[model samples]
Target: MTNNMTLGQRFLANEWSALAVAILVGLVVLASMSPAFLTEFNLYVMLRSFCVVLIVAFAQMLTLAVGHMNLSVGALGGLVAIAVGGMMEKWGFPVPVAVLAGLAIGAAGGLINGLLTVRTGINGFIITLATASAFTGINLGITESIPFYNLPAGFVAFGTGRLYALPYLLLPPVLIALALAFFLARTVPGRQLLAVGGNPHAAELSGIPRDRVIVMAHTLSGLLAGAAAILAVAQLGSAQPSIGVDWLLMSFAAPIIGGAALTGGHISVAATALAVVLIVIIQNGMVLAKVDPYWVQFLLGALILAAVGLNRLRAVRAGGA
Candidate 1:
């Protein structure tokens, strides 16, 4: 489609292109400033760290696509982490069984969120906020704020092992991103999801099940969140109550920066992937520059605002054109 366009036109038309350029620029700058930046060890570390964040972002992105928010993403993730951890460490469950149970729990949590929103006709923001508290309460009640150690050896190894600069952890997100892109662009249910988000009334008139799609989106969001939590457990070699404490911000940040509209019905898997890369680069650069870790929150907040403003401006210009 872009073959006939000029380079500038291509850049303007494809959101991911701009993100790719930004990532490239960030990589060059960081590599120059810190000799350690491009080393195999640092590269592996960055890749592994991004794996969980990318999945978490995708989880939130699904909810946003349905014109809703999932404030409970982090809380749900923390719950899943501990649940899976307890299953493995205390219940003598196998890894696969524990992982499946954790995902089921996440889906159930999401189901509650969906049913409440649909039944009560309350805004999703409110529904998710209330659920967030509920999820957190459950987590705290079960774990007592303690972490679960003694994860399986193979799982921990997969989280940390790498070939050259590529961590084994990188595989899941890559496959997931590709599958998501395909699903959104090509699948029937996927189209229905976006169609409902694009115009709920119109979709209903066209015989699409609006409530079902929203519920499905929420359920998928929870499943992905569960996957991310499990991965974090493997990476840390423990299931900490704090596993998802900081995910709320980054989960929203990457997808929004990737050009997902707050109003819904628009998202780009490729663009979101690039946005995650750019964010990871920025974080690594800060570490190399000896910046205070606390500043990351401020920076991410600022970046989100900037991205929203930029997107609004672009919309205005496009409308004008």
Candidate 2:
């Protein structure tokens, strides 16, 4: 059976190949349509934008791996951004200390979400939704809807620095993606996470500790959210209350478009990264074409629906095959 597949058939059957083709086509078309599309500065801008969103998508992807959803991803990110900002500006903390504290805060928030869901036996959707509101409330209460200006100049420089078309901000996400891929494919806990997501009863029967895996996923989600928030602060040169305001859409879109199963137990780090690349291309193309920014939001909404439909169709086909 394995020897019978033709090269073309195998390429078509591999999920990421389609996205790779789409991206190549998009790059060619956009470059032809707009001369500025391939310019070094524009390339840097697109790569910079890709960094934080990739992490945010990873945050959601981890939770999705366990058949759970995290409505609080954006809210928790917003909270962490301000908390880190305040640590730096108000408390006079250094960058490393502030960043570590922010990550810890994110982990703590995720811990709360996981514990509540596990202990109460509530749907994660409901648990995260409720916590989303709570996180937002705390964010608003802390800053009074204000932003933090005057971050360290060195941090800001790292955010905007680039070599040719490669952004310095690109490094962390690349390392993270590699680490995540390795974890999911090679590590025991990571494999256990997918197992729990794939079949809770079977995993439990196998002594895989289903509850522990769910909690771990949520905690990792929160940690990624924190990383994203820090990146956002660096990119903008300030910590704004609106940092994670629009992350909800992109977070879900990237992973789903990249072929993650909402049913859990399936994901691909490389595919998700490519999906982010495709999204960035679309956005950059729209900007070059001078389309209204609001249309970008509408397009994202439409893309989500299309991706979901495509996933359903693929699942049906796979089941039949």
Candidate 3:
């Protein structure tokens, strides 16, 4: 009985519980209102949408876990998309090679962001904000706001391929979520990263090499952002300069709503995944309900504000307890 109560309490305390309930409610309401909502094609579209957003959410989640923010996530992703697209179209590089190169570029960009933040004593927000501008400028310069239209057939096929009702694109985020869960829960470096986020001074005193962990977090964030960019390219069958333009909000929204601490050292991969699902559902619901396109931005902002407020309340209650 004691164990059961403990488990129940833990579930209630988890941020994912609220999100899960919301998702269930959304699904029920949408399905009842729209006969097309649960159709195979609609379900596939929703799952496909989840692929890129989930990875982007994880990218921001990693930075948040280190008590930092990467305002450049969307910018970095856009730059990478353009780079890879150019490699395949202009330079005629094979898809695999271009992808590997893009990933490397992303890591390098992240490394620079981390080094600048640590060495200059600048807040990550400012550093990444500056870098975001640089990235956007480079992207615009290269493509002149035009997208790469010609991509490898195999690559484009992967983006559109579905196994029955399941999108092949769903595999990456699921694997990433599992890997992130294991890394955070079991690995020494992951623990160190979380430790630094939880309390940097204590972690430094404990010989955790705080700076290194921070850099690692940023680098991993970049890599994930790059991966998402690539997936976006595949999904769209074109490399648009605007691929990640909207990721900034969703990137922060999913993790924050999933219960990532702003101060860091606390995040739940499972919860984040559920949060993404909920967001996707909400977006889909709006489309099915024929909500005005202009209202989507307003709705997103309102949801984010609600999530932040709820988190603050939870923090206060925990403190009081």
Candidate 4:
């Protein structure tokens, strides 16, 4: 009986379980409410939407795991979008080369954020916020608010291609999720990153290079943000200056809702993925049910508040236990 009770406690404390349950519940409710919810086209739309958001969520999640936050995820993504788009459109660079360049640019941006934060002893939030502004400035300066419309035929085709109800674009996020889950669960560096976030003092005492780990987290976050930007360009079949404008909220919301600790050290990629699905479901359902588009923002805010409250309650319960 004691063993069973302990297992139950652990289960309740697991964020993945909560998110999984929520996804299942949302699916059932939406499917029942809207006949079109399960249609091939609607399902394809939802899955396609999931791709970029999931990657962006992971970007923020990596920062959260290192006891930091990247306030510039959207800005960084927008910058990368324009960078890659410009390369493809103006320079006439091949898709592969442009993508590699974009990823490198993303890493460099992240490296700058990490270095600035560690060297100045400033909070990452502040550093990222400043960089975010800089990135947006550069993006606007280069494009003057215009977008790149001419992308490679192959790239555009991949973005729009589907197999039954599954989108070809879904493959990247799935692979990324698996890679991340493995990195976090099975790798030494991954564990060290978590250690730093969970307890910096302890991590330092144990010989982990705390500063390096923090920087690595930010760098990885930037890289992921860049990848998401590339995917966004593909999905939209154009590179818009506003590519990541709305990503900041979703970036934070999905991870937090999926059980990432704001204080750092804990996050679940799978859970965050599920949280994105839930958000997508909510947005799609709103359209199906004819809910006002403005209400979507309100609902998203409410969900974030609810998730935070629930996390606090869970923390209190664990403390009492």
What would the per-residue lDDT of candidate 3 be over residues 1-321, giving only the tens digit for each residue?
224446655565567777888999999999999999999999999999999999999999999999999999999999999999999999999999999999998888888888898888899999999999999999999899999999999989999999987998888878988999999999999899899999999999999999999999999999999999999999999999998899999999999888898899988899889988998999999999999976778977888888888778766655654
How far out, in Å, is residue 109 in model 2? 0.8
Q: For residue 313, give model 2's deviation from the true position in Å.
A: 2.3
- The residue-by-residue lDDT of candidate 4 on 121-201, one tens digit each, is 999989999999999999999999999999899988999999999999999989999999999999999999999999999
Task: Give the TM-scores of the predictions, in the order they appear.
Answer: 0.96, 0.97, 0.95, 0.97
Q: Which regions in candidate 2 have their CA more than 4 angstroms from the true location?
A: 1-9
Candidate 2: tens digits of C-alpha lDDT, residues 1-321: 335657765665577987899899999999998999989999999999999999999999999999998999999999999999999989989999999999999998998999899989999999999999999999999999999998888888988899999999999999999999999999999999999999989999999999999999999999999999999999999999888989999999999989898889888899899999999999989999999988888988887787778677766655554
- The local distance difference test score of each candidate is 0.88, 0.91, 0.91, 0.92
Clashing pairs in 1: none
- Once fitted onto the true fold, the runs of candidate 1 whose alpha carbons sit more than 4 angstroms away are 1-10
Q: Tell me the RMSD of model 2 versus the true structure.
A: 1.4
What is the lDDT for 180 in model 1?
90
What tens digits encode model 1's per-residue C-alpha lDDT throughout 212-317?
9999989989988998999899889899988888899999999999999988888878778888888898898899999998888788898899878878876765
TM-score of 4: 0.97
